[model samples]
Target: MNQEFIDHIKALIKNKAQSQLKDELQKLHPADIAELLNDLSYTEAKDIYRLLDNEIAADVLVEMDEDIRKDFLELLPSATIAKRFIDHMDTDDAVDLMRDLDTEKQSEILSHIDDVEQAGNIVDLLKYDEHTAGGLMATEMVKVNENLSMPECLKEMRAQAEELDEIHYVYVVDDDDRLQGVFPLKKVITSPSVSKVKHVMKKDPISVKVDTPLDEVAQIIEKYDLVALPVVDSIGRLAGIITVDDVMDEIREQAEKDYQLASGLSQDVETDDNLFKQTKARLPWLLIGMIGGMGNSILIEGFESTLTTEMSYYIPLIGGTGGNVGTQSSALVVQGLANSSLDSKETVKQVSKEAVVALVNATIISMLVYIFNFFRFGPTAIITYSVSLSLFSVVMFASIFGTLVPMTLERLKIDPAIATGPFISITNDIVGMMFYMMLTRLLS
Candidate 1:
């Protein structure tokens, strides 16, 4: 991604120098080629793509952003796509590309694919839900029967490893293809060749069912520090394997989705998205904030006669403080839920802990404001007591309200992230105004 390399590629593309372009592409990694393509126009990108070897082309296709890849694929013929990219890609990557196409297009691509086994694997993967372990697993792992000797196992592995790009672990299966153990790659060189594979293999290997959720699969891989995890059918037969790279992609996507929701976006969106798409994702939360502002205005107007100009000056402070406190509380709850550190069952404990923290914060903030107002307005002034008291009450209420809302959302099987940012801030602003007006009236 250096400027000099990019400029060289751009110059070659501009001159229509296919020979130089192919030479430069061969020296760059597939990901770097993808980055160059992203910076180019459709025609320019197509030219660069055509220069890549089939294996590199397949890798570059996977590295491209999903939106860009879809448009790129549409410009190519089905036969070319199948023969050049799909045939060389891993089963998981092929399934991902197929998921983006229509049924007719998928069928056409599958028919054009030269490898029958790869096509069959893609079709079987397409049958599973996209958010499950089956959808994330690949049929490229090396497995051997437990009854085979070490020499026999190594021979079988050589044949299987030829088709795969990387080998992390060798699985040992029984006569029924049931996953029984895992044999480490290092054992092939270190262990005695006279022994059967089962004797050297570690028994009771860790694995997930094909029906397991993607989130749980990610957690297992992360917890065990595994390079790859095995997937099994209900009957304990080996189905496929999910690599660490695939789990990393899922984790990154989930993090981005949560960040978007917390920022008040209704859907996944990028800066390069069209104006209509950007507006649609942002408008709902903006409308909610508008309604909340109107509600606060009405609440203030109801107490207009009870307040002097001095009291009116403190309205912004009350609303802004509450909003800040509420946003902080909701953000913490959302993050805890996402990282699995907070459980819905422990809602009471979390709220209680938040209350203690809020109490200390409320007392310090209220006292500082009270001291400042007391010097300006004198000890007997209604503005002094009412502003400070309203602040204390608002802080306590906002903190508890924010903590409870997200936790309740999680308990109800809803995404808790939506309760953060603008949603909590707007709700707290309206409630804070109501509290300020009520406290002033009662004190006066």
Candidate 2:
């Protein structure tokens, strides 16, 4: 991560000093190695990747940016990718990596994977909707039958723990494999060995169905402060476990996606993406904004006869105020929805609160603008009263419109984030112009 270390690595790569590069890479963490790979050309990165052992390479692959990892994966054969990387990766991570590949490539990679069980688990995971708990869950977890004694449970846990990197909880299941309870890791040392697992374990454990949405899964984990959450099938059978680390990744990805949507991007994009990709992601929103601008011009043209030079000077102020207010309202609504702080049922309550806030803001802003206009024009001037009234109306309308649009979208099962930024601003701008022109004409 340091500049000097990066410069040294680049020099070693340039000089083709394989021994030094291997020694240096071994000293760094997988995530740090991934950061270095991101800064290097694909060929240079691949050279460094080849020096890593299979386990570290798998970890490094997971840590790299998706676009870079995709390109890197393409350079390797299915056999090497499967036997070397996928075999060493967690089920959820393997599914994530495989999802980016074509069907044929996925099949080939599966075929080459040495562990039949792992390949099967990946295939099963791929069947779930990518946005759900099942897709994020991994089969790697420690579980024991509820009938086992504490000593027996501990023995079984030891065997299962060998296959896992870390053990968060020991799940207890019935004869039917239905999840009955959770065996706390602390109980292993504290509890007496005479008791059965079912008696010793905490009964009625909190869990999620496989079909639960990824966002809800994140909320559950966060709310419970869990390091892992159990996933259940329709029959209440324990299917897999979702680790906190994976849930954290899901949370980050969702936040990034929402942020992109709020910014008016049509798709996920990064600065390193190709020109065409970047253009494609940005152009749709830009075109929409342009259309909105043209529409505003036409609206102004329609009201041309009513607008005196003084009246026309206030148009920008009205539109800009409305757009700024709308954007702020929509952003708050979108963030509240994302974090589960705002419920669809609370729409009326939220809008009412927003209206009160808007009223305060509108009153202050309109009063300030009116005072300035009254001093500049005569107090009796139509422009003064009309402009002030229009500002007040536009602020109230923009705030209410912004709050309701996103909440309505969410109610309709649409992503509310799309209603933020440009969409809200454009809508508020056009409507603000109409309010100003209509109020002015009537007042005059």
Candidate 3:
């Protein structure tokens, strides 16, 4: 809604027109209500949120921004949280909300849940690392036995389907509850009632282990174009299922985090986050960049006589080019790693490719600078050759350095995106200045 509509709602809130406010909010989708709540004060949000029905309130709670939801939940009692929100949420979402609460609060909320089985499932899921398939999956999917006849399987599926939002596949399992196959809904009509579930279902269906990494799970779903992927335990028993929507949400959160790290933030920081959190995420890198700048100044001071002020004139051209080239190279390598297109096994090949591209860029850039210097300072001046050679060396070194750092980080099990941040930019700047001074000293 626009600011004008929000203002109208705020006016209703101020006037304490409960019925009118309730009527207007009832008309909004859960996502829209969540958005509207985000734009209001805690008092206003709480007042408006109370008017929503339990199911819509649970959905709106899930849709609300994480920061807002955290604060909003704090004002509520544990019993209220369990009854009004947790009762209506899917197991996965409930676990997520539980994770945000303190240990004492979590126990209180869990105790208030009416569904003992669902509460147990949430507790079981919470044991896994949040970055695993086990944590991301929901226990709400439909599963039937392989021994059932077609008619029996269909009956079981219909009963379970009523409880779920949508049925992507009806999982078939053995008497041991081990996954045997996936039952296609089309087969329900096409296959005869006389056939056994195992005989008609798609056998040896693709699935991921519960302990599989979340990223690997996303890759499997993406590769096979699955709407839902079943999770299995160590013994191949069906555990839970991860839906496409959950995977998409995970992907978006991961992308945002990677972007923040690449931009030099240590952790995720929203604009609305408190001042200390914002500063905390941003300060360490700014301090590191400061140290790098000081190091550059000291290096230049040490070579004040050799640099001869004339060559110093192009320090910006040399440093800027190196930083820009390094940033470009690191960004591409990070991107390739994220999308799985570039494997660490091909490190030498990737670096060699970047080197060749660097050579072409270096030659063009250095030669262009050399020509400009020839006209700007006389052709016979040391400034001409030294500037061009320094640019050439800086470009080549920066390119190779940039490409290698991320690849090495990946091999060492560190995040490669860190290399694409101020880490690359500052390192290249300092090193580029050193190359410039050394080249100028040699030429003179």
TM-score per candidate: 0.96, 0.98, 0.97
**What residue pairs are clashing in model 3?**
none
lDDT of 2 at 381: 96
The order of the candidates by lDDT, greatest first, is 2, 3, 1
Give the range where candidate 3 is weakest over 10 consecutive residues by summed lDDT. 307-316
TM-score of 1: 0.96
Candidate 1 residue spans exceeding 4 A from truth: 2-7
Over the stretch 285-403, how does candidate 1's per-residue lDDT look in tens digits?
Answer: 99988988888888888888887899889888999999899989999998888777888889999999999999999999999999999999999998899999999999999999999
Write candidate 2's Cα lDDT for 1-444 as tens digits: 888988899999999999999999989999999999999888788789879999999999999999888888887899999988998998999999998888999999999988999999999999999899999999999999999988899899999898888888889999999999999988888888998888888999999999999999999999989999999999999999999999999889888988898898999999989999999999999999999999999998999899898988888899899999998999999889877999977999999999999999999999999999889997999998998999999999999999999999999999998988689989999999999999988987
On lDDT, the leading prediction is 2
Q: List the residue pairs that clash in candidate 1.
A: none
lDDT of 3 by residue, 1-444 (tens): 899999999999999999999989878999999999999999898888778889999999998898888888888999999999999999999998888878898999999999999999999999988889999999999999999998888889889988888778899999999999998889889998899989988999999999998878888899999999999999999999999999889889998998999899999999988999999999999999999999999999999889676776788888898889998999999889877889987999999999999999999999998999899888999989998998999999999999999999999999998999999999999999998898888877
**Model-by-model lDDT, in order?**
0.91, 0.92, 0.91
